[model samples]
Target: MESKELINKSAKKIWQKWSIAIRITPLIILLALLKILTHYLGWEVLELNALFTSLVAGTIFLIGFLISGVLSDYKESEKLPSEISASMKSLVDDTYTIYKTKNTLTALEFIEFQKMFCNSLINWFYKKEKTKVILKKISEMNHFFIELDKEGVQAGYIIKMKNEQNNLRKMILRIDTIRDTNFVDSAYTILEAMGFLIGCCLLIIKIEPFYASLFFTLVVTFLIAYMFLLIKDLDNPFDYSSNGESGTEVSLKPIHDLRKLLIDFI
Candidate 1:
């Protein structure tokens, strides 16, 4: 197996087990501790200190929230297919036409085209097992198709391709599975959004005595805590991605290499 395949597989497995609270909670706790320290150190008690305190704390929380958002996006990117892009789809469609058509080719040219397509897919998939599995089925179909295209066309090859197509279709369906949110993620996101909104409201209103404002500010902090956990939960695409099938690692390297092997025959 290629190194890229191993990396993707490992990433998928690790992503599957990711716990948002475990990864994100500590940071929230640390921020809370910093706030407490400021209060004890008279940092929040100095002249006109309430305004300064809010600004500093708000800045910290905002940065942490942004980081969480970035991580969420990262996980999503891992789950999606590069082929989902329009340009790549066009490229694949172009090559697929070659296979769809009946044409005369020197054995070497067929093998060359096959190898190139395989290589392109390999780069596209970044060497994941799900892609590997897809390639294997495609190879089986291609081989049978070649046999049928040889000296005589056979009816059985159609049956074989159809069977292979079914198998491939199942694999494609698996890629569509998206996991549901466990309580932690759902609750956390809800809490964080509430906190952000409440905190903004309190700040804008300038609630006096500082204590009342502080209490509301704490609400915002709590929301950050929840968001931290939610981000952790949503960061892995395999289990947490849009589909259950999204998180699996897939690679097209084997198909590319297999196509290269055909060139040896020429």
Candidate 2:
């Protein structure tokens, strides 16, 4: 078990490193490809006018812009999980406060419900499966609040708790939508095509130093692949796994901390 844990930890570290590297891999690849093209053109091995240089530079600029857009999308994606976590933590705290003040449910019952709701939430965040189960659990929580409302709990407190629950549900739904959405698909397709075109351009160059051309081509290819993998991995930050393990995921530390707080409250 220890060995397995160690391997999992190592794999997570590697994934994190690769994830960071992939963000810039496309630009690096493009520069390297351009450098090779420039060298061959300068050596007169590949006959092309200044027009070709301008075109290559333009293409690099365009691709760099696309990468920037992708990075923007990635940053947006990173915010969502934290948003959900915050909403959840607030909901948990608010629920506990309501329970304490209203006395609609016994401590044991509130704890039991809290445990079930929180467990379902964490599972939903991590497993991202069993939506029916999560929805059902949420319905149960909502129903519990409704029951409290009927039992002479202050309408204001009940309304606040319900609103928190609704916000939590909406955030969860947003997360699910994000998980299903493909933010980077179009960007990736464009990048892949550009990479292919670049590769073709490289192949056409009649450089005498065939090995150098070949080396540069390989590097560009690898870099393009790296970019694709990186974008895909980052597109849905919640869904990626390197070794089919869970720890490489976006940190659920906020939720975990909330869980501890819930335990303390109980």
Candidate 3:
């Protein structure tokens, strides 16, 4: 089978990812131009060196903190799909064992359950289905494991199967939590507020020549606004539909491979 390309985020595609952030460019430029105009009109520009410096310093630190926090979760999310695939593989092996142990019909029924469970995951990861929808399916898979108990399968195999089932449920819910939540809601609020203030500062502060002010204002504002959008895009690794930077998302190939493996069983 052909490999799916993800890491080859060409410069053009990378620029496209900036599209969301670029929407604010016109406004940032307007602010810079507006600042330049104030100089031409001979209006007094506020030159608070310490205040401007402190604000930029504080905001930069805050952005750094947010990036560090969000990255940990994003890294964790990347591993979950592969781990989940492994758990399902183990679970399928247990179910197959039951089939050979003379509970053939019942075991095959459970195999059907496995297929549905895996398919639902692909949909859920795509955001086509909500958390509760997937939770209900997971609950059903759990109960199916219980049915195997009466088949007189060895206690050890049953326990192992149940454990694998638990692992699957745990990882899916983990992904759901990451998808539905933010790294820190209040932190994001603060970042946006600070971003607005910095934009205002860039427009109102006194800098050197008109050209210098224009250069600093445009460059600084663009970096701040771009990172704000990029951080938000990174915070939700499962947001596959976003136009944000490519390859930021956790790859789904493991899940797809698991789906293919399940289909082979059916």
TM per candidate: 0.34, 0.70, 0.82
Q: Per-residue alpha-carbon lDDT of model 3 for 21-70, expressed as tens digits? A: 66777877687678778778865367858877888888889999999999
Sorted by lDDT, highest first, which candidate order results? 3, 2, 1
Name the regions of candidate 1 deviating beyond 4 angstroms.
1-33, 41-118, 126-150, 173-188, 194-266
lDDT of 2 by residue, 161-207 (tens): 67777876776777677667776566667766776676566656655
Best-to-worst ranking by TM-score = 3, 2, 1
Cα lDDT for residue 45, model 1?
A: 38
lDDT of 1 by residue, 90-189 (tens): 3233334434553424223444544554554444343343555555645654653565457343445345445544544453444433322332455446
Clash count for candidate 2 is 0
Model 2 spans with C-alpha error above 4 angstroms: 1-11, 19-62, 106-110, 126-128, 184-187, 241-249, 260-265
Tell how far residue 73 is off in model 2, in angstroms: 3.6
